[model samples]
Structure formats: structure tokens, C-alpha cells
Target: MLPLALLAGVATQLRAEEPRPAATTDFAGLILHLSEDPGKFHSDNFVSNEPGYPSAIEGLRALGIHGGAYIGVGPEQNFSYLAALQPERAFVVDIRRENTVQHLMYKALFAAARNRLEFLELLLSRPPPNAPEGESSRAAMSVQELLTAVDSRGASMKACEQTIDSVSARIEENFGFPLTDKDRVTLRHIHSAFAEAGLSIHYSSPKAVKQEPTLRELMLARDTYGNHVHFLASEKDFQFVKQLHARDRIVPVTGDFAGRQALRKAGEFVRDRGEVVSAFYLSNVEQYLRGAQYAAFVENVRRLPLNDRSVLIRCAFEKPTQRLPGDHSEQADGQFWPHALLLQRAQRFVELYDEGAFLTHEDLARQDYLDWTSGR
Candidate 1:
């Protein structure tokens, strides 16, 4: 269980010393400027529901896809991708203002912690048992070992309250993003959920039928090749994300994919900076768009500048009688997700729309998943 401490970019070139993202002088103002007004309804998933998210990383690397800009939705799962892709900057757009506020909570956590163990410490509100101080030593530890070393005691009301205060202060004083009373309440509610559940927390949905993996399972999860690739899995991955957050390279925006302003404005910013999106993780939000909304989303995606190597990382679940076309076990299904971890050319996506291939959401979902070997 959690100790109750609760939580919590660059799109750049492929090189290790790649240039960082253009300066973000105003984080909150930029969020407002880039955001569309919140829709009437939105998914309230604070944590990622997708356990198979990392499977795409293996394919991403194998295809020589790395760095540029990453666009995604939902929660901490984006951290895992940021660790892998190391984009110059990222725009994590969701339809709800709560999502942006949630990202701010995460940003504060990232700013507070320095290493993987420290990150886990803040995340679970558990102090490190005997964490190593050396970067190399922490890098040598696996996620399982690192998490095992975290304090197992449940959270104290005092500690939980302190974290809430500290996180709010950090966002205001350090990051310059003030939290409204309502936002603070939402942040507290989200953090309280984390404290009550700790590492055992899993995505909850009224519509969920099967058990989703816990936070611990997701952290310990590996890519298709049996390599643990989640952000907290390695100290290096953790720091990559941490440093990026410190620089304000990752941003959150509110927008319905079908709505105007959000994606187009975000794309405009990236384009103005001469950056192109390399990968986009849509989860299963596409399943929610219908008719005109779906068409508007396709049009919005078309506005983003993309490169040949750019790809879309999406999910589709298996059916009782008809499984998605892949031998991989990285599949999830219920209502939202329709298939497993899927990778397809980003250019191909817009091309398909131009070719009049996606008359419906099913047509978009029915498009072929990229074969792994052909790119290599």
C-alpha cells in the first residue's frame, strides 16, 4: 500500500546532446493559451489504464524511431514514453481541465524528487529504506528492487497533508502555476486516492469488467522483448523525465480531440519552433469520437507537422470471438480499448484520411498495425 505521499519533454533531436525544447517562459499562461475549453464530460482516469503501453517502446526503438515531439493523453504513462523518446517538448492534451491540473501535481512531484528511489518515495509517500546516493548505484537497481526497498508502512494523515501543502507550494513558488481552490481540491482528492491505495492502485472505471494491473505491475512491466522500460524502471529513465520537468519541457493542455483550438494551437507552437511530432499515444479516446467529432479529430491531427519516421502509438482490445491481429499479449479490452499496442506511420494516418479511408471510427481502428520487422 502507499505511504500516502502522492504524486506526480523535450522534443529534440536523436542525439544524446540534442537541443532542448524552445524556452517556455510562461507555463500556466501557455496552458491556457493552448487549451480548448473543457468539454461537458471527460474521462477521469488519473493513472493510465493501459498496461501494454511499453510494448510500443520496443517497436519504437527497433524502427529507429526516437526523439522529436511526443503527443499523448492520460497520465503517468506519458512519463514512460518521454523517457524512451526524449522529445524536445511534449503536449499532453486531454479534454478535461482536471487532467492539466493532474499533470501539475506530477510536475511538483518530479521537481521534489531527484532519483528513481526518491521519485518512488514521493509517489507512494514511502521513505526510502536504504537508498543509494550514487547515480550509478541507483541505475544498477531494477524497478522491482527499487520498489521493494520503499517503506511499506501506510501513509500518515500528517504526512499526506504535508505532501499536499508542499506540492501546491512548489507549483506556485517554483513553477509559477497557481492552483485555484477547486484545483487544489482536485489535487487533494487525486493524491488521497494514491495514498489510500499506494503501489496497489490500478485504474478504476465503472465500466471495467476485468482486473487491470496495479501500479506496481505497471512499473515492473517490460516491453515486448522482456525489457523493463517504464520511466521509474531505471534511474536514468527517471532522471531523463525529471530533468525535463525541471526545465518545464512537458506541458498539459485541455481539449476534446474533436474540438477546435487545442491540437491546432499546440501544433502551431511546435511548428513555429521548427519541431515535428515523432509519436502520439491516443489510448482509446478515438473510440469515443463519433461522426463530426471524429472528422474534426482527423482534421486536427492533419494540422500537426510530422516526419516520415513519426508514428502513432494506439491501443485496440481483443473481442470474445475475434482477437486483434497480432501475436502479442499486450491487449486490453472492455469498452474503450479495442486492440493491443499498435504502431502505424503518422504520415500514413493523415494519408488514409486524405484517401477517404476513414469514414468511421471503425475504419480508423481497422487500419493495419505496423509490422515490426519491415522497418528494421
Candidate 2:
């Protein structure tokens, strides 16, 4: 079972990140649709760090659109990318500080709840020598036992609700943004969407607690540290390129190297000059940056560079556990992890672009399992 201390930390991290819309002086109804996997869609829709998932940069160049109120691809993704994409777009929110407290609170509550579930697993399992006395050894359950257990579980769930409430309250007190039920539901909806879409919820853990913390912290820290000095310091660079093209009324091309190359050449003619923001799984970095994998990416890029300018890449971090979908093994049936599929599609894109990058990809879960069994 996970340590109680870890559970608390996870909850803390979540509440820190989640946003409470009602709490803000002004609300921007910006629905950020993240790509669970960039490769899943055609190259014309989404601009992601990965090879597939549609090219946001090209989309901007092709669409001749700039700032918007609704949902659709645009130039400037996260904060840094926004600066480079449209140094003029002022409505951008520094996502890190935007709803941090609420985000962290939700995460912590989830962590605590998950830990309780893990502990219950131990308690309800077949009793062994280490098992507490009077606990049943059999996995099978009688009708009464089952019903009673269900009641107990219901109580536990209620406790979980309280935990979240407490955290939310704390967030309100600290950040001056009190979370209303509506705000909580919206956040939950986003989490549900990510899970349903099969994309990994990167922020489903307390990053600060990890031995090798996920990249979310690195990116956020870099931005926070360099906020005053550099606009694109830590934000991924792909969005910047897209925004720049959008502002110039450049049309973006999505799909196939020939079309993209044509777009790139066109961008130059239209005075295309802007930063590119992109991200990728850490496992596939070698494919884009160096070694044989890099060569493969080059081969693909030669065919289609997607965007027309300078690019920046940043790593994403994992979120607290509860904010993440339930364990995949359970197949609880409500929602599937969309991020996983998103990444899988992204892998496909890399393969389409440069098979070398695809070859370098690694599964984080597989590694974790190996490490655990081998006591690594």
C-alpha cells in the first residue's frame, strides 16, 4: 500500500493545480482541449509536441486566424509558446499560477482516496499470517458481508468527499478563489474527458515527491523562474509559430510532407518568422534530438517540417494519482485513458515522420513494473 504521507502529498499537489473559475475576478471561458495523443488525429487539426495530432503551426498558417473565444487550434499554446506565437495576444493566462491551489487540492483528495482504496485492498484480501485477526481469509463474500462492505465503502467515499471539501476550502482561503460546486464539476469533466480520450493525465501525481520528478515541474519552474526575463523561456515553442502565422493571415497546411512543405515555403513568402512550441514523451526524445532516432526524424522532417520556423520543446509533468483515471486493470468502464491512446497515435505519427523516433519510444509503465519486481 502507498504510504499515508504520499497520499497527503498527492492531494496537496492536485489542489494546487485545479482552477476555480468563480473565484477569479474575470473568467475566460477557454476550454483547453489537450491532445491525449497527437498522432490519433490527422496532421491538420492538432499541433502537438509529437509527430501526429495534426499540426497546430500549419493550421494557423493555413487558417488565417489569430485570437479566438471558442475552441479550435490557434497559435500560442501554453504561456511561453503564446509569447512567441503572438507577443500581442494579451488574454493569455499563465496556467501554472492560474488555478494552482484548486488543482493541487483536488489531486491531494484523490491521492488520499486512492490510498484508502489501496489499504482496503489489503484489508479485504484473503488473510495471511500478517493479516489482522478476525479478518476473513476467503476472497468470496457472503451476502451480508458484501452488503456491509458496500456500506463501509460508501462511508469511505463520503470521507473522500469531505477530504476534497477541506482541501477546496483551504485553497479558497489561500488563493482568494473559492471553488464552487460548478467549478469542481467542470474540472472533473475535463479529467473525465482526458480519460475518455485515452490521453495520459500527466498531472495525476504529486510531482514534487517523485525521485525523478515528471517534466511538468521542469517546464513550470523554468517559466516561473524566467517569467520576467524571457517570454518563451520555458513554454513549448510550437504554439508560438502557429500564432505568428495566424496573425499574419498565413494559411496552415495539415497532412502529408508535400502539402506541409508547400505551406512552409509559402510561409516564408508571407514573412513567416516565429517560434515553434512542441513537446514529446521523454522516452522518444532521442528520436528527435540525436542518434539514429534523430536521423529517422530528419528523414521525416525532410519530407514535411510541419511548421515554417524556430521551434522550442518542453517536458510535461505527471499529476496526482486521484486526478488520474482509475487503474487501467480495473477497466471500471466509465472512461478509458485517452492519453494513452493519444500517445499511441503520436507514436504512429513519429513512425510516419521518421521510424527512428518511433523505435526509440519506451513505455513508462513497463519500466516501472520491471523496476518494482527487480527491487530497483
Candidate 3:
């Protein structure tokens, strides 16, 4: 076992070995992949230790992501720890880490910009016709309206642009790091892919998970912009939770009083929004069902409509809280898979859904045309 000081020393030594990491791209285009998982763990955790830590890079290389970035929460996860390990093979980015206060401000600002855009769209579609004579209008009211409208257009455009620019500038001003264009493009690509795949993923913080309606409408709109879009819920919110008996078929008790409720809410939310919603339990459902319940849970999941295109599952093991080890939701730690592993999973999602392939409007409009129609 490494002493705390020794581990800290090793971390320092790694930076000294390579002051600057290598770049993964060679001009073809960014081999885009994203991972929302945090990398914190015990000193001995597989992902933190050597050998296991490198598997993520291996996975991305396997997926042909030679030059791309891995997105994480903070500098600790973004800097040397992960990127240094793969040195130059990948770029690491730490997106916004603000809590709800600052997040709401950004959201309000984005809404204002989006509203301004809509107003412009409407104005362009139908320019006001010339004012009728004797309408108490100036002789050049129409022309003036056009010029005033032009000036208004410029002001509103600047206002909308400034909202994003100022917010981004303020963030960089305070944090000393600006949001990179690559980061913005990565998010747009993900959201576009998800939308094309027919999955509606919301971009919001844990505190604002209830904004599903807003997220859905945003996705529906032509322009959806953001750097970080997360699908998470506040465990404290009753509106986000549903009560379930331990005996419920979809939820297997894992020793926590809240386990049944969490599982129940996830299952019910997925089912209730059927057809209109694309929901997936990305956590390791297999590991969450332990001992006597694991077999039953696995068996039931196979029978469920899990393989449907609208659903996705990415399983990873985690540490269970109780002395009794095995599959248990409470034990789940997200860091079991590094950024590379998460990126591979995202690629698998694209392949699994056959996204980005040509599909006509008629084909898409066919309600039953799912990827698994061939029975894979």
C-alpha cells in the first residue's frame, strides 16, 4: 500500500515527466467522445492504478478515436491524471462546475437569447407591409420602420450574442479558463447524435432535473446549444421519486431503505414515458441486484423491452456499502470505467442504433422501424 504522501509524490512525479501532454488529432477531424463519470477513487481502485488506467485509451484507440478529448467535471479529473496517462493521445476538458445559483443565471440568459432568435425568425418571415395612408403614420414610417427595425435587429442580435459572450467571458474571467470551441462542438455533436438516434437527453444540473419539459422543447427547436447537458435527478425530490415495495418485480432490495424507491422511480419513469421518451438506466443494474436477487433481476431484464432502440444500458461494477459484497446499487461507483470506457460506450450507442445512416422521412415516420427490427 502506498502512503498518502507517497501517492501525492507519484502524482507530482507524473507531471514532471511530461509538462505538456500530446495531441490526439492529426487534422482529419476530432474523434469526438465524451464521459460524464468522475474519476475519484481509493488509492487501489483499478482505474486509478496502473494497467487498468490505460485500458480506456486502448478502448478509444479500438474505436478509432485517435485525436479527441475526454470531458470530465474538474481539473483534478481533466488534467494529468487521465491525460498524462495517455499523453498526447487525448485532450481533457473540465466543463462548468458551478452549483445551482450560477447555473440558473446561465439558463435564464440562454432563454433570453433563444427568445430573441425566435422573434427574429418571426420578423423575417413576414416583414410588416407598408402602413395604409391616413394611418397617422409618418410619410416614411414604413422605411423608418425598416431602418428602426434594422437598428433594432442589430441591437437585439448584439444583445443575444452578448448574453452568451458575456456569460462565457465572465466564466473565463473568474475561472481563468475559457470554454473551447471544440468543447462546444463536442456537445452539439452529442446532442445531435442523440436526437438523430431518437433519444431526447436533457442538459441540466442535478438540481434542475425537473426541467424535462424545457429540455424536450429545446431539443425540438432547431438550435440547441450548450457545453454540458446532463440527465440527473435530485434524490431528495419527491417529484422525482416513486414509492415501491421490496416485493416489486422491477426493483430488487439492496439493503438500503431507499433502494426500492430509486429502482422503482427509474423503472416507472422509463415505462410511463414510453413511445414519446427515450430513457435508459445507464447504471449497472446487474451489479445493483445482489446475492439471491441478481439472477432474478437479470432474467427479468431480458424479458423487458430493454433491447429496444429507445432504451440504452451501460453496466459497470461499484463498491457495495454493506459487508456483503456482490451486485448492489448502493455499492455502485461510476469511476470503474475511465473516460475511454465511457467513450467506447457512446460509440457503441451510435453503432447499436445505426445512427448517422441515411433514413428517409417515410422510414422514420414508420413508428415500428427500430434498429432491432432485424432481430439482432
Candidate 4:
């Protein structure tokens, strides 16, 4: 075997020689690819402005995830994780094409805005509060203060519509990605959701029968030990995501997790850049995957570049009595709630696959992978 120092040097040399995705075409290609794919698109809006899932920061931090590629499904929660992980690149894949359009809208706003406050101003269709003209002035305002400023001004339907149209047009004209009529209409509704609701937009599930927490509440939510883990909870956290957006590092792709094309192509792109997958956030999608779909997803994941440190973040819903290690929950009015976010090493999943141990979602969920760092 090669010496440790020699192996490290060789790895660094190989990374230096790899080709990176071009800034102009990387995002455009991802958008166009989703447009061409055959994945089923949902019509109704599935906007998740806040993370409805459990927090995985403790696991990610323990795994030392940084400066690598991130893959996940869903909305703004991805930005929060990206802010924390500071990945070189990120791909947000969802079955619904509307999600892709929503991300495109975000990309346009990020390209247009100069900072966190400016981004909020454009997103909420409201002006910023009067403050000194400097970075310190903006940073001094807390997340609550920012929300209050936005809510103080009622949603301006006319102004918000104009801004949305202008940004949508810029996305097509400047970014070179064409948007369909339906996409434009859908984008407008998404913008209205944020503008009208401000930070109070709650997580609305298609299958939900009851009310859920708003985005603001989720951001301020603490873990069992009273720790703030949401991405926008701090100015430093907000700046981290803003900088990543400014650099065009976050790309949204519309593809099913079990599909043949998207994840495979993403793996190819990461491999060409000589980077490994640091973390993947699978937000309760596995619960709906059938046998064939589950197998296909595992096969696709096998194609991605990963190491022992590569981790899978999964969310599961169980009874409060059936909680796993590191699981966090809250009790409301004496009702038991069981929501678990688990992190496991990628290699362990590969092992389970080889042994035919993952025949069902329950099989995958019941494992003690939550104790991910014990054997390592």
C-alpha cells in the first residue's frame, strides 16, 4: 500500500486535473435536461419555505461535511443545509417540475439582489427598514426583525406581480432558459405565497388534514436541548447561503429519485469535477418508494462518488414510543408525535443493498444506522 502522505498528495494532484462545469452552461443544461425528461409533474404548488423535517446538523457536523457536493430534494431547506455545509455545488431534484420553476425564480432573485436584506426585499415585495448604509447595519437586524419589517408592509399585488414578471423575463432572456406559459403562472403564485404570507407560510402537505407550523416558527425552533439549527437563524448563516447563491453554485433539477437519468447524470458531473458526495438529504420520499423504485434509487446512488464519510440524511414518521437514537420530537396537548431524521454512512447502505436487506421501506427504517459514528 502507498504511504498515507503519498496517497494524500496523489489525490490532491488528481483533483487539480479534473474539469469543472462551466458557469454559463451548467445551470442552463440542468434546466433544459429537466424539461426534456419524462418525469411526472405535479400541478398544485408544493412550496416548503421552511424545513418540515427534523434537524440533521449534529450528524453532518460530526461527519465533517464541507467543500463537497450536496444532493437533496425539496425547497428552501436545501439552501439552509448548503449554508451550513458550504458545498462547492448542490443539485435540488424533485419529481414536480413546478419545484424546478420555483428554484429558477429564486436563482433570478439571487442574481439580482446584492445581499440578504435585498433578497428579502425583492422576495417579499417590500422595502428594507431605514438603517445606516453598511454591511454592519444589515447584519445587526435579527431574523425576527427582518420578518417584522416585511410584514409591516402589506403585500402589494401590483408591485409584486411586476417584479415577478420582470424577474421571470430576465431568467429567460439573461439566463437563456425558456419558460412556458404555465411555468410563468406557477411562478407568480409561488411569489405571492411568500409576499402575502411573509414568514408565516406554513408547510402544507398534500396529504395533510391539519394545520402545520409556519416558516418563521420552524426557523426559530430549537432542538431538545434548546439549540437553534435552522439556516436563517443567524446573520452568518444567512450570508453563507447568499454567497453560495451569488456564485451560482445551487442548481435545481426536476427528476424522480427512482428515475434513470437525473441522479446518474449528476453523478457523472461530480465525478468529472473530481469531487465526492458529502451529504444527501432524502426528505421522507423513501416512504413512498415501491420495491422496483427503491432498487433503482439504490443503484443510482451506487454510481455516485462517495467515501466512508459520505452520509445519507433521511426523515421518517413513527409513533412517539418507537423513536430511535438521536431522534427529536415535541409533545402538543398530550399528543405523542414521532418524527425522526436519521444519518447513516453511505457504505453501510451499500452493504445492506448487497445483502438484500432492504426489501421494503420499513426494513430500511428499522435499522440502527442512527448510531452512525459508533463503529467508525
What tens-digit string does per-residue lDDT give for candidate 1 at 127-218?
75577678778778877778777744666667678888899888777777756666778889888788778887877665556666778877
The prediction achieving the highest TM-score against the true structure is 1
lDDT at 86 for candidate 1?
85
User: Which run of 10 residues does model 2 get worst, by summed lDDT?
Assistant: 34-43
**Tens-digit per-residue lDDT, 244-348, candidate 3:** 101111111111111222223333434454511122222222232333343343333332223222332222232323211111122112222111112213323
TM-score: which is higher, 1 or 4?
A: 1
User: Which whole-number lDDT from 0 to 100 does residue 287 have in model 3?
Assistant: 30
Off by over 4 Å in 1: 1-25, 40-43, 130-136, 318-339, 374-376
- Which is superior by lDDT, 1 or 2? 1
Q: Rank order by TM-score, top first?
A: 1, 4, 2, 3
- Which model, 3 or 4, shows the larger lDDT? 4
Global fold similarity of model 2 (TM-score): 0.23
Tens-digit lDDT track of model 2 for 59-96:
22233323321111222133332432343322211112
- What residue runs in model 2 are displaced by over 4 Å at the alpha carbon? 1-77, 84-201, 204-296, 299-376
- How many pairs of residues collide in each model? 17, 67, 10, 0
- Write one digit per residue (lDDT tens) for candidate 4, span 1-376: 0011111111112111233233345557665564323234222333442232435775666667777999987777787778768899898877666678888888888777666677777887776455336777777777666666666666677878888988888777776666766667779888888888776675554555455556666666665446666666667777677677667677788666777777888888888999999999887777766667667878888988998888888876654346565565666334334566777888789888889887766666677465634654
Which lDDT value does model 3 have at 167?
A: 45
Worst 10-residue stretch by lDDT in candidate 4? 1-10
